[model samples]
Target: MTTANLPDLHDLRERTRQFAQARDWEQFHTPKNLAMALSVEVAELAEHFQWLQTGAATELDDGKRTAIRHELADVLLYLVQLADKMQVDLHAAAVEKMALNAIKYPADTVRGDARKYNEY
Candidate 1:
């Protein structure tokens, strides 16, 4: 999808920066710390689905869904902070990765296949 279809990531990044600065948290928001926090948030998000048989959208109750949403927000916040500290443009990196992925996994050749790019 085009960036026009995306939310204002730059705005989000600025907001994250302001939030950390206001709290004097920048000293703690090193890329390594942010990465670790991101991992923890991801694990929390995953825990919400740990026991689900299929982990389908329909499988989540309202409370569980709400918890998952908060976990996801935490993950995004950490990622934004991490990108800022690491001097990386998260959206641009994602777009570049998508381009690389297209080269690595051509749709026509990998259609209905579940193998690694190198194996294909």
Candidate 2:
């Protein structure tokens, strides 16, 4: 779908839930399984750029880009499923984490640095 027409996170989560429910797949969608699946998908996504130099990944052709997109969708689906099963609101969790990160890595101190928060 186009960027403007993409489904919202809640809608996507609902749809993913329905898809799993319809397939009686919830038994197989435990947080551990979903997390593992998410990790695999992330690895697959990383494979696309494994040997590429900086800025090369963004130069992928349409087919490679499409593959990357599908890999990302897979990662998101598993992450959403895992969060839903754990009764977590993904958006809220992300916002809260960002807030904590902002505190841990204040711009004035962390800007242009790649060190861990503890090191900063």
lDDT of 1 by residue, 91-114 (tens): 899999999999999999999999
TM per candidate comes to 0.91, 0.88
Give the distance in Å from residue 73's predicted Cα in candidate 2 to where it truly belongs: 0.5
| Candidate 1 displacement at residue 54 in angstroms | 1.5
lDDT of 2 by residue, 1-120 (tens): 543465587777888988999999989998898999999999999998776775275678788888989998999888888888899998899999999999999999989999999985
Q: What is the number of backbone collisions in each predicted candidate, taken in the order shown?
A: 0, 0
Error of 2 at 35 (Å): 0.9
Model 1 error, position 81 (Å): 0.6
Count clashing residue pairs in model 1: 0
